[model samples]
Target: MTDELRSAALESKAWPYEEARKLLKRYPDGKPGGAPVLFETGYGPSGLPHIGTFNEVLRTTMVRNAFHTLSDLPTRLIAFSDDMDGLRKVPDNVPNGDMLREHLGKPLTRIPDPFGKFDSFAAHNNAMLRDFLDRYGFDYEFASSTDYYASGRFDDAIRGVLRHWQGVMDVMLPTLRAERRATYSPVLPVSPKSGVVLQVPVEVVDAEAGTIAFQDEGERIVQSALGGLSKLQWKVDWAMRWVALGVDYEMAGKDLIDSVTQSSKIARVLGGRPPEGFNYEMFLDDKGEKISKSKGNGLSIEQWLTYGPEESLAFYIYREPKKAKQLHMGVIPRAVDDYWQFRGNYAGQAVKEKLGNPVHHVHDGKLPDGTLPVTFGLLLNLVGVMGEGATREQVWAYLANYVADATPAAYPELDRLIGHALAYHRDHIAPTLKRRAPAGVEVAALERLDAELAALPEEASAEDIQNIVYEIGKSRFGEEGGFAELRDWFKALYETLLGSSQGPRMGSFIRLYGVANTRALIAEALAAA
Candidate 1:
């Protein structure tokens, strides 16, 4: 580790460590009844699981890992799915849309699976949540709302909330609009006859008896607070989940900060302490709008894993998690590169240094041994040079010339990185790598630049070649206004060489692509120009 980073590590205001300290203070000795420190992250299974949802769980896990370093108390993280909640509308992506539409207002567990793979839509999404988590080897207990409610696991918590219904009302009612306040009830009864969650006024709440009496389509139904007879409102459910699970800590997106505050009030009313948590800013899409699963604008879990390694996504979740970061296909390469720069160097670092790096938290203490042989952006450029769908053998060929003896067997990640780079190039890079005949001035400069490459030393290092490329590119045009003129010349070189207005750091790229290959590429581009 660098002396500067090691020095910063001593006093780094890292979030994970800060959150860990807060979590230890909350538990005092983990939690009541000898239960381990419980950290829960909730998911609304109304749509396919997205990267945003995964971020919630992964970020919580990061904290959990951080907490382990602070104390020896056994801890558990729950990946809770609100699957029992009614499916108000069909997701556009699911199959059998008409079948799902008919089940509107019915619990997701009651509706048939749109894909016919699971018993119900909720089960399928829950399975997906589990599968993704398991695929990444997350250590978390899966808690399904359907199972929790149906099995009467939350029966006591449900009854407690009802007993303190007025307190819950005071916390929730103020947040609702005037029209909403008139009809709002924390509990929404599931009609036995119609099998739909009825949104109606509560005629009577027999809190002591744990029953709710409400009118549903002219029928007066008295439903038990136990056995999934009723589901709590969003805020109420959040509170109840914390109370029932005995959550000591958790984290959420900023959009839920208001709801978490309201839930904290409801939790106190329900006679349990609220979990300690931080509300992070939302992830913006490419358009700078908040990413939504319903809107289908955010990166899907499949698309993210398809184009990049899971660790890259982990790096994204750990990187500036509190900031409102932009997530898009364009953001993958930097994340991929970050894996090497940060986590790659984590193993040998001092304890204080590791504290500053989230790699320890992201990997849960068992950090990977080494880094990637090359940067992902360089690989993307090479993929473009190698053409789309380039096989592993072919990629390794260029890679061997670039980085000696580079093999997938030696670098385990390279096996996946190889295919992922090709796909990423085709999907995200190739379009930008579109060929164009350089403009009149650009053509003349690059033609001169090509001739300079031929005069380079045969044994020149990447740095040496890079310096030569820089000088050639910068001075191709007369140096007028120094920095801006150099920038314009570099811009011309990018357009001529990369066929794009921007590119990877040039010197390293020229070195990695091999001086010979880079020279040939420049000559070919100039000839075409």
Candidate 2:
């Protein structure tokens, strides 16, 4: 960044840099002893990754970006997945539930791939997670729970947990309900008989010997502390992952705050401090409930990408991290609005507000190189009114009429928006489209409007067209009912032409779509009416 941008970032508290500053304070002297600054974002590979997964990772990237601008230290992010977790239940979205159930209690890495492609279900999901993150060009290291356990890389932390079992239990047991506390054990053993990780009673604990004897199949059995023979329970495992990777920071949804609290305590007992962290609010679905994989109600990563660009999703995350936010399809337009609003204000904002806008952090202090030639909301509405089979060039031609220079090179964002908007129209808005035919006097009024439009100058501004539309409303409908009557007339016009009662400003739409084309649309609306 230039001196001015840097100065702005220094004073801003709205962005996530406050957390970054805290991390730098903890790792003073610039990563002392050449250890890279580590930030970890974890996933449970029980289901396909979703928007919530991206939200956490992307938000962490923003903080990591801010950290980089504030310091010259080497830093790394670890996209960790707990693939070694037991397949407690089959995910709702994956193909075969019975097949997954057949492997219940087995570690995810040990379960067969239901799809017949990857080696195992866990491997399939891990690949998907990596591919998604890689597609976004995220800079990070990837780690698997299976790799850490089988290779014994987590041995030190595992050993520490076994030795400090009592302390770990003390920290975790209080967080659980009554019955769980009576039989709580920091370790869960892999049953030799069933080849499954089992939640059995611990008959004996030998922290000194690095072993635990767990009851399995009506018999007591001993298992090694590490080497894939045994693993800590989720709470303890979460803590050990931090220690094993030397993670300096991690963030989780508000839903995981209790787990975080217990894990942090376990980390302290295991001879490592829990990383500094943040508990971001969860993304709710359209119904205002927390979006969950089990419910299958929330939008997925692919769906978001299908409707809008990745930067739009990033902007959604930037709006607010601590407070709860909704991530359904309905919020996309508003996010795009914020994106335009933030970028438009960057040049004139005081350094603090400019640097504070999530756009700067979203791009890692570098502003985006392109602009959306039109509001995505307007573009989507235009696509809706354009009806079916509208090609890219057709939309581009309309945009160019008003923009004069709406070429792909000048407005790549607009090009993508136009394409996605059409897809969104077909997939979401078209089936219920309302094409009302004008009734009685409305027919003559539309005819007059079409004539007025046809008589317009060779060129006219959006406002000019809007004024004509307003005049049509007043003359035909008599607007003595205040703004309400004008709004109703426009609503009727939108319903008649676009199949919706609300849409982009008619004046703007007409100008962008061309006066001749709009006149034809008015004729079509009259015919349909």
Candidate 3:
């Protein structure tokens, strides 16, 4: 390692962004000769791509970006669609047996995108990422395992891996016994809860060509990988592929850490060097749950793109790759708000770096941009609260478009903050339910809130609305504690009426949603009561 790299590793505490940047700079002019530093990622095609999958891409993309821009390295991001892997089970909410029949034994890459615009299964899976990358201004080379297996790219590596297959098994079996309580080849899935294990058998059809067949524990034949003239076992396949592809770094969730560890050992035994980087990231549901496909609790990447801005989503995934955590859907508003705040911080930094000034960009100096330093889910809700005319679709569209634009240069920061604030309102605020009151009682509360809003002057800003609500709150509840009462009352009233206690602040919500429209809603609530 160079002096600069050693310094960065120590000072930055081995952060992926810093480490990746240092890798490029370690070499003169950031060139690894003919060997291109590869930022690699892969995902199974068993279900709709989840938000966590996006994280895998984002973490690596950040590394790739740092190498090219920060370290001035010529690097490439290689996308691997594990479409040749067998399907584990049919995901929930999908059309059942029929869908599985079409996809059974096929690699996820071969599965058709539910949207049907893509040509192959891998294409379908890759397209979700393609859309995300395009939306986020990233460019990558997409490769499919099936294609690589067929193209003879790993011929030399495959032979080496096979020669050391026994050693690979020795390393993997012990780890499996220690961590998972079973020893099986690369494709086996261990039941996390029951500790039960199922061994997947891979049939070696052509040892010379690298073609194989896969079968379940029940001996049911699943998929076949016909070697164009070469094949390796699952463990060997992994190690050889990494070397063959020249992967410099790959990030995965905690679950895959074991597999990668095993693969690393195999890489060493086979006389091929393991990739230089590895990062284990956490998976989070919208509400901080461990996102899982089997439990049917994970949020799809599509859903993420639907509700949140691309930048916030990216930041959420990349913020801390080493920790394992659940992301709850309920708390996404807060997350969005935090991301926006961070964007504002970035804006401040950019200004300081370019124009050399410090100003109230937003959220003071607590959050910054480009570094994924803050959360803005709340701000997204606020934006939703303020934009009465916006729909969830429209809001996401605005965010998607905003992040895509290259102009105004600093627009992403503003866009993220606004997007988070708006999203928070739509997802959390507008859907509130009266927590402590009956429908009839809540209608009365709505009437009271409406009365306060009705008194506000025209052409008001958010602060004006806040002041009006605060005054009404003071009048109704008492001078010292009135604001809380008013705020609580509005929360209940909106929940009863709009189904969310979290709506935009009453005054601003009414104004943006339009006084006439809000009044109409309140009147309806009263009538229903």
Worst 10 residues of 2 by lDDT: 477-486
Better structure of 1 and 3 per TM-score: 1
TM-score for model 2?
A: 0.93
lDDT of model 2 at residue 123?
A: 91
Off by over 4 Å in 1: 1-12, 344-349, 477-484
TM-score per candidate: 0.93, 0.93, 0.66
TM-score of 1: 0.93
Mind giving the per-residue lDDT tens digits that candidate 1 earns over 1-529?
A: 3555434433546788778878767767656677788889899888888899899988888888767666778898888888888887778777889988889999988999889998988888889888889988889999889898889898888888878878888988889899999999888888888899877777445776778888878877777867888888888998998888888887888998898889998989988899988999999899999987657788888899989988889988887877899988888888888877887678778767777776766676677665576788777777777666677788887776667668877777876888888888888777767666666666666666567667767666667766776776566546443334667766766676776777776776776677677778777777786
User: How do these models rank on lDDT, best leading?
Assistant: 2, 1, 3
Off by over 4 Å in 3: 1-16, 21-34, 96-120, 127-132, 176-231, 286-289, 293-296, 324-336, 350-465, 471-499, 510-529
Give the TM-score comparing model 3 with the true structure, all chains together: 0.66
Q: Best by TM-score, which number?
A: 2
RMSD of each: 3.2, 2.4, 8.7
lDDT per residue for candidate 2 within 273-355, as digits (tens), equals: 88988898988888889987655667888898898778888888877788988788878777777788788777677767766
Per-residue CA lDDT of model 3 for 142-258, tens digit only, reads 777767766666555665554455676777667555544333554332222222223454444454544444444445443323332223445556777787776767766677676
